[model samples]
Target: MGRVKHNMVKSLGKRTSSSVSPTDGSKKRSTLQMDLEVLECPICFETLTKPIFQCDDGHLACSSCCPKLSNKCPTCAFPIGHIRCRAMESVLGSISIPCPNAKFGCTDNVSYGLESTHVKECIFSRCSCPALDCDYTGSYRNVCKHYYSYISSRSTPLHHYAFLLYKASSTVRMNISDKIKIHVDYTNELLFVVQCFRESYSVCVTVSCIAPSSAKVGKFSYQLSYTVDGDTMTYESPDMKRILKVSFQTPLEKFMLIPHSSLRGDLLETKLTIKKVIQV
Candidate 1:
């Protein structure tokens, strides 16, 4: 989505694609900041994206929601089409605010003109891992750190369980003692990613079905087993979706946090399997 600022500004709710650059935050939010909420698309209530649209009376809507309006503005009930909200866009460009992910160690305070563009590729933006029953969300950097740490803590040997590979060339089979991880893709099949997370001394296992959020996947389950001291500990959960959007099928922190001294040896071996439930 590139910005397309027009030379001729249209109406109040009309939009332009020019550029503005400024950076400020960590201070009190001005009234303008709060008032900016008015610029949100009434349909989705999200800040208007580029090519903002408006009705004859200047009611604003996002480009996405505009086509769905049946050529009528929600606010004024007027026929709406073809008009851009240039005035509102100019106002938005003048505002400088912190990135929404500022709390997550993002030190950027960029101008509103490029806010959406920046956020689309913001490094500070948090994303979820595909692991089932996991709630880990952070930057791509953090996700890498967490993924490697978790997988290495409870990896298995690939030689023991040979499987099909989508692209064997780039997919290197790496081992962490008994743990193994390899990447694969399928043109028309669900891909499973076995993820492990270490909490204190306990280890959590997640069987991630890698796919898109919109994919219609059936419910599934995964199991993990390990013994500690003299007691056997096993954890399992159902309803694993093929894709994880924001949160996990189960909680990560408290699900399987076990004691470090409970393992028979320093290495903790775990097993995982996934099956989609079918309904007749």
Candidate 2:
């Protein structure tokens, strides 16, 4: 699921070969990367997996792509079915591959058979915090530890405000986020950011909202409701108001700690919906 969110595909293509002559008529061998591409599944373009299936004539397809194929091999009209390519599986086992989330801060070198299991539990897998007033994102387990704190239970009547984060890592404030105040010279020209706070005795979730770019932002206020640590709370931002040409990136502001063991299933599986509440 996490892999799908980023749209970073890991497809491989069928072995490709062509006879060509360069201007200099030099013959060069294909690189290792090119060799790897030869193993890609022709159906999905993703890299092949173990237990690769093949036709009697030896044309190959991954376990995932094999089931989707017709009875006949796409490459050759040979009879194709659930024939495991043990040789290919052995080849896969001998290779070491990096976890897909390596770009996201995960640094694990897993054997072919264990790659799936490692990625499933990669700590750096993204589960961003999207609260109403701040913007922040962290690993799946960690993003659930942040939230917002508003000046008023409802919207602040005024527009000028500063952003702040309070630490509840323990009874004492483990760390306090830096106060963010825009550096505008004039008096309160109605420019400020709000930070709202909510906590639960169980299932704690942290939130930080990232405001869209001025041009991309719509006229919309926001609301967030979550039950955490056996506590339920809802937070509402000010009503939608359009801004003019001036713009700034939304600042980040709060967090509440939640342990992963307490959650029921994959943290990546948890989905939060953002509704655009409208008033006539």
Candidate 3:
């Protein structure tokens, strides 16, 4: 009976040792797996790219991860400020990222550091051409051209003319007709009159009896009348004079005159002149 008891005890000891070995092994394997899975940023499930360290603690996070969190860590409530993590960042710098919008149209994949910039400037970004039935897909410049063509096609028929005026010793004369246009003149204000029809037009009229250095000289006002054959529109006031003088100061390159042809009906002829300026 003693021998039987002895044998049973030995068997039980062997069984216990066997079971303990596997448990210890399994625990070690599990720990290693967890360590392999640890990554810097929780926001992006991937390994940290462009890792940034917290100011309060030496905790590391991904660059893409920090913005979503409050200025502190929820775990420690440490005031998290931006600090570079050279080690983690170097690791992330080696990673390549597929374009986030690859499914939309972008075909290029770039390093994680350059991903945001490339995506922002991607040419394949979806944009609609405002022109009807024109399904054009290209860069920004191409899209601009498409809109320009649309405007030109829809433009109303109009004529444009311009003349250059040079200031002489005693008088001013029109040197050459730079441009002329049939334009729709809206109400004439002191500074500008809204013209509707023409694509471009300008007229140059010279002012005489002005001192070169005097800032107040050569100021004048003129009543402008628009008459096409018999139909007439007249605007006369001190304001009209101010508008013409202002036009002279404006660069010719920036000048745009709206034409009458762009209007619904009837053409109007117009005459403009400078009245006088108070000598200073």
Candidate 4:
């Protein structure tokens, strides 16, 4: 079924002379102004693709939905899933539109039927500000302007791609929240948050990234270590979980557990290292 869909889109590409790139010297496809809701699969509310199925009464469903509905039409008790709606498939295959994030500087044109998938990984996807008091939401590219302004005075600067031995200062220890904010350089502006929680016999430390969970922008790895009485304890993470907004809820997993006895004067000290991984 997947191969059929791919081939249908491929064949439609040959039928049109649209240039995805204007500089490629190919003619652009003619624009159409049709109601897109007509192309959605009513059952799933997703854009309809090839293999659209219809009932005798004209009720339509996508291929995946036809089987789930037990080969019966939802609107009418009539049988479905056998007949192919080739006219609808051709309409879906020929339609393409600029990404929804095009307003945020995305230039790629994607098939109208696949726009939902493209939006999930769009680099220009908007992210909510992680600062508790701020309700700002903007594209990752333009958000740093609002981000750095608030955190510059209170956040610690992090040196990327290297290990930095950091000691928790007295001021941080005295803070009621026991949270530390690290701001990476502007070029790769990612906010790292380290939060400490006091348990009955241990101190739990967690690190997280503040970014949109769906944005496919940056990949990072981090290492945290603490040394007590000549013995060292370490925690390394290949990737940090991203959050859309700041929350006070305690992490349920993937936290570094440190014994309260390992503390010197009740201070939490650790060596922190972070490296950004480039994806091909």
TM-scores of the models, in the order given: 0.42, 0.39, 0.29, 0.56
TM-score of 4: 0.56
Candidate 3, position 227, lDDT: 47
Query: What is the TM-score (0 to 1) of candidate 2?
Result: 0.39
Question: Tens digit of lDDT per residue, candidate 2, span 1-280?
Answer: 4234223333432223333355566875432332544455665666677667888888888767665666668888786666888887766665666766788766787774465556444554444333335455554224333322222344543233332221111111111122221211122112212222222432333332233223222223434444546764454444333222112333233323334444443221111222233444
The local distance difference test score of model 1 is: 0.51
lDDT of 1 by residue, 1-280 (tens): 1112221111223332334334553443334214444656667666666778889987778888777888788888887767988887776666666776688767887775466566645655655554443578665445545544554566652222223342221222323232324233322334455544455655455545444322143345655555545576776666553432433233443234546566454355554444445645
Regions of model 4 farther than 4 Å from truth = 1-29, 49-51, 56-58, 63-68, 81-87, 152-183, 194-218, 224-272, 278-280
lDDT scores in order: 0.51, 0.42, 0.39, 0.66
Query: In angstroms, how far off is 121's CA in candidate 2?
Result: 1.1
lDDT of 4 by residue, 106-176 (tens): 99988877875776567776767656666898865445556676556655542112212322211112222
Candidate 4 Cα deviation (angstroms), residue 89 = 3.7
Best by lDDT: 4
Please report how far candidate 3 places residue 96 from its true position, in Å: 1.9
Comparison by lDDT, 2 against 4, better one: 4
Q: How many residue pairs clash in all the candidates, one count each?
A: 16, 28, 23, 0
CA displacement after TM-score superposition, residue 105 of candidate 2 (Å):
5.3
Score residue 191 of candidate 2 by CA lDDT.
23
